[model samples]
Target: MGMRLWKDMQQIVGAGFTHDTGLPTWFEVAKATFLQETYQKWLLYKDDCVKMIETELVPQGGLFCNRTFDRYACWPDTPADSMVNISCPFYLPWFDKVSQGVVRRSCGPTGIWDEDDNGQVWRDKSQCEDELEVTAQELWLKQLMVSFRMLYTIGYSLSLSTLTMALIILLSFRKLHCTRNYIHANFFLSFILRAVSVIVKDTMLERHWGREIVKHSDVSDMLSHQAAIGCRIAQVMMQYCVLANHHWCFGEALYLYYVLIASVFIDNNKLLPYICVGWGMPVLFVVPWVVMKLLKENKECWAFNENMNYWWIIRCPILFASLINFMIFLRVIKVILSKLRASSNQRGYPDYKLRLAKATLTLIPLFGIHELIFIFATDEQTTGLLRYIKVFFTLFLNSFQGFIVAVLYCYANKEVRSELKRKSHNWRTEAVLMCCGQ
Candidate 1:
């Protein structure tokens, strides 16, 4: 049994041993003695080893077993690797919630302590120092934030490209410059800017990828300090664009309602007021928000405040716009149905209603109705499947807002399609004429 134990121990540590393998430490002898229960004894020895690592491995001491022992101080097996509160003795300030001063070094597959890139065994002190990686939930949340940013980056890029094309198409055609199209164009422009701002914000936050927390009392403060002025500008622009997007959609709904339901006093051609409300009104909300945040919070940037009352500067306007637009939508539907019924064309009502439904669905992103659903979409009570569903669904809908707007308003618009066809036909005709002349 003794010979077998010796051979087994030799096999495990032999490759790392030097010519001067020296006598085994008391910890190693303890480990060798309880060979039948090597696992438990090693764990106890590991704990004891740490307790006396400085004394045991001193040059004058006789505890050295092998050169491998020089690098690795033995550590006990943790019940859960993820929950281990790893600390570093080299650093000061006892990390909060670490439960005493010691760090949790991982017990590796070889039943030895993990080593650093330099071959020096060390615990990941960052895991304790950085609060972001402290808990499983927090780590997952951090990853989810990254995923959200990635999703937003891709989605908004598509939206930005499409929106720019949409603007070009609208501006290229003078005929499509009526109140509704103008409002749509304004909405597109707002979202385009919003997309750009969000992209910039994400870029500035790229350093947070490695689980390092950006320390600040607030997100606005973090942005202001960590990032350049462009980040703050982008954050402010996002706020303005978000508000402009909402207001412009409201303007669109109102214009549609006036044209369809109450057009007697409404001059469709005089849309300067609508344009002002769409483009200019957002400044009212954004300026005060910036000023207040600067004065009161010394915020991270012009980022959203957690308080609903504080956010009331932007939220109240957006919410009011959404409510008003929804009301206009319902009123428009009622008027359309009534007109059709009075004309004795009940058969056409279903098709008209279906079209209206599609129109309403498309407008949901524009008017910010989808945002209301997000209020209840928090992962507070969620776990596992539900949490994933809530996060993914929210991200898909929220991040892809600009894409959805582009698809519905620009790519799918009848006027845009007709304009494209007309341009293509004229181009072909000009080409043919030039060929004939040649």
Candidate 2:
């Protein structure tokens, strides 16, 4: 009699499982077994059947067992079989009510349990998958942290050195504040901003200090959003400033060649505006693009894709600027060689020939090859490794620019060296007096 009642319940549930169409063999058997057990439990405790299934059986035993069975027994190709075993048990009326209530309260009306006419829930599966993938990739961020630390160290050190060298030169040799030094001062200013950006972005991403600050702050969300916006602006400005420095360097080299080789001279005061244009144009071009991107793209962080067209917009100008600088370097070389040949013929000895050759060789490692690395390495779709390499090289190369320029143009001249030494001694004496007074 009991077996007959269980079979009757199975027939009812089995009919529901198979609509007008057919059902899979495995799904039919699983549905029959589930209905038979549910009917037996219902008979034993009629009022407590729903409570037992909802609280203890379905939540603990039914869901857990169904999940395990589906994982191992379900055919990979049969979506119907998989769905029946994994999903149908959750629709047992009581479980459905509890699940719906909990989901509605936590996720609102458009919650996970909200089903369409086809009885399929409209959940954002892609969002869940993306979160899972990001969590998995968190381990790789350690490497990025290391790279960021290295870049910050190199950039900060180089920027400070460049600024110190420039300040010393400006104060000690006031007479040497010509067109070149003026342009260099602007470059140093930009480098300072770049250094600050690097340190801020690196610290935020790697150190978790922002997270700690947010824990303690009252208006954490507003502060974080502002910081994010500021960081993005800083990054874009830094890159534009770098390009501006390259442009100014190219212009300086052109001016030098025009004066020395082409016998063309322009007044220093008249050339100041052109110098300003070299630095100013890049900022103008980059600011609009950044503003538009900020309006459209994600605002939670500063990253490469903030301006998707950054490479396309900036590449042409940078390449053109690099080419112009290379042309100036070639002209300088040609002029030096011509002078050396003339000197050697007149004196029957190598006068400026060895010195010029040595200077050119030294510059190959300093300016020529260093800039070439940047030109060659800057691809539109740079990967993390490539980005790291580019930043590392930029920091390493530019860090030495001020030192090399000081050595070649300043120390090489006896007058500038004498003035630098005298200024260094005076600075040291003043520093000692201040410390002693304190």
Candidate with the greatest lDDT versus the true structure: 1
Q: What is the C-alpha RMSD of each candidate to the true structure, in Å?
A: 15.2, 17.8
lDDT of each: 0.58, 0.49
Clashing residue pairs for model 1? 219-300, 220-299, 220-300, 220-301, 221-299, 221-300
Q: Write the per-residue lDDT of candidate 2 for residues 20-58, one digit (tens) a residue.
A: 111112222344344445444433443343444345532
Instruction: Identify the leading candidate in terms of TM-score.
Output: 1
* Candidate 2, lDDT over the whole model: 0.49
The worst-scoring run of ten residues by lDDT in candidate 1 lies at: 17-26
The runs of at least 3 residues in candidate 2 whose Cα sits more than 4 Å from the true structure, single-residue gaps closed, are 1-148, 151-155, 204-227, 268-271, 295-298, 306-310, 351-353, 361-369, 379-392, 411-413, 421-438
Reference-based TM-score of each model: 0.62, 0.56
**Clashes per candidate (backbone, < 3 Å):** 6, 0
